[model samples]
Target: MNDIPEPNNESDSSAPIHEARLWRDDGWTARVIKNEDDDGWAVEMIKDGEAEPALVGPWTMGRDKKNPKPLDTGAFNTLVKTASEVLRRHEQQLHALLHKSIAVTTDSGTINVVLDIVPDEDDPYAMLSATDEFGDAIAEVRVAPTFKLTRASAEAWIESGYRKPR
Candidate 1:
């Protein structure tokens, strides 16, 4: 039924179970399915409470060479580890893309300028801010998400007396 929500990581949740084609364990589910591009098998690893799979790759063929190897504890554990790494890397990449900072020297001294983007469906924007060496907030302004922060831009902004950029 489409009504039942998938299992979440909780103490009372169902225990890990492994079937020939599906294995659910350690807050991850590994499913072996037919490869759409070829006449081979592929395994997909999906994290708990997530719709999209985090990793998918070719599966080892069974001895018969016509079927996929049954999912086992060792195989399932390896898949979970790989999928977790993939998710972690993706998160790091996203963080670097959305947050940027630069240092520029002014008459008063040097300050660190940072741009933090807040993505919203209806009102997407970014916070352009500056901080002193002691981590004190010097200035901040709302800017378009497309604002590109660089040393030159930061210097110009500070030189303008912290005025909002055009």
Candidate 2:
């Protein structure tokens, strides 16, 4: 027997699932949606550069039956924080997988930049470190993977002098 329940198209047969989009400028994204089978809500967080979402936590219901606690400033702020964390964790993992060391041809001969990705096991945090040719640390940064790491992004970073560590 088929275990998956097929999509039932009867609109009024189930509770209406309300939809709302949550977006952030700092590479965080989420969607707050009402459950169709029950009187509940859920929030889905999608991190940057991740193929799958990090979390789908339940949302709070408002006093009124027909409406939810408005998506006010507080709500937006909380969502941003949650989504950002998710992205950070995702990036940390990718950074770990991306172990690369390269030598740059600067005016003064060549300098080696060692790239390291350290993942935060307890929390949703990741660290990227860049070391100089002599193994001296140049810069270290905590990154959120919500930013794309494609060739386009790489080219953009190079063009921008790699000032921003996303």
Candidate 3:
């Protein structure tokens, strides 16, 4: 007879599917699953309400190569921390890639300069824009994604009447 409990149909969708080697916490879930590439164990850490796992790594093997070391408070806590860091770094990197902002002082007034990149498979482009202190858009232009945005470049663009870069 199997000792593990069956999944409760009444449980919330966000709730982790608990088994012998699965654990659910407020913000994350840790589950031990078979490593499809090899005859070993791997652990997947899924964040709350997320469809995909934030981290998937090898699990320590027990005396039997086929069995994984049981998940404990210490191990689970470490996994949670690692997985959270991974998600944090990924978010930071994506933010940097999609958007960037800088403050510049122009003859008119200090303005917030922003560069928003739109990545397309065939053609990538970026939008360069500037806003006044009151959040009014002063100027905007579309440029290549590789265009370098700096104080000098922004000043030049504004001086050129928002002309498309050469």
Candidate 4:
């Protein structure tokens, strides 16, 4: 399924003004975008490879409206951690849906873990991984899949844990 599509014509602004900015922590990278139309912002965390955004939610405006809280060591660190978890969970769900045949024997018995991976256009190494369960890798193709692996449930499968059968 088509979750979040990149803006077709991103406004050319030096700063993230109304665009998403990339943040890096340890090895994970997160994209923080300003929601000009809304009162909040959205964050997307990416790991190794996957499709879609890891965490897409509201962001605080700190204390000022014109200025957002600066991206510092502590703030960046916290964002990375939270974003990573979001990505991880998303990856697990996507995996489950992809491989419905593969029964994940959880305590519930025969639980499924689906996942999907959205690749980065600029860089071939980045992708968004989300899953249904917790830590399963399902749709792990390159940045972008040659074929279509689209669906919310299927997307959730990618989020779940559906690796490329490898």
**Judged by TM-score, which candidate is best?**
1
- Which model scores highest in lDDT? 1
RMSD of candidates 1 onward, in order: 3.9, 14.2, 4.4, 14.4
Ranked candidates, highest lDDT first: 1, 3, 2, 4
lDDT of 2: 0.53
- For model 3, how does the per-residue alpha-carbon lDDT over 1-166 read when each residue is reduced to its tens digit? 4332333558875675445478776677888887879978888988877889999999999877668888877888899999999999998999898898888787788888899999989999999898998999888888899988877887777778778777
- The TM-score measured for candidate 1 stands at 0.89
**Residue 69 C-alpha lDDT in model 1:** 88
lDDT score for candidate 3 against the true structure: 0.82
lDDT of 2 by residue, 75-161 (tens): 666776776677688777676575545566555444444344444565544344445557776555565634434445444444455
The clash tally of candidate 3 reads 0
lDDT of 2 at 104: 60
List where candidate 4 sits over 4 angstroms from the true fold.
1-22, 48-52, 100-166
When summed lDDT is taken over every stretch of 10 residues in candidate 1, the lowest stretch is 1-10
Against the unseen true structure, what C-alpha lDDT does each candidate score? Answer: 0.87, 0.53, 0.82, 0.48
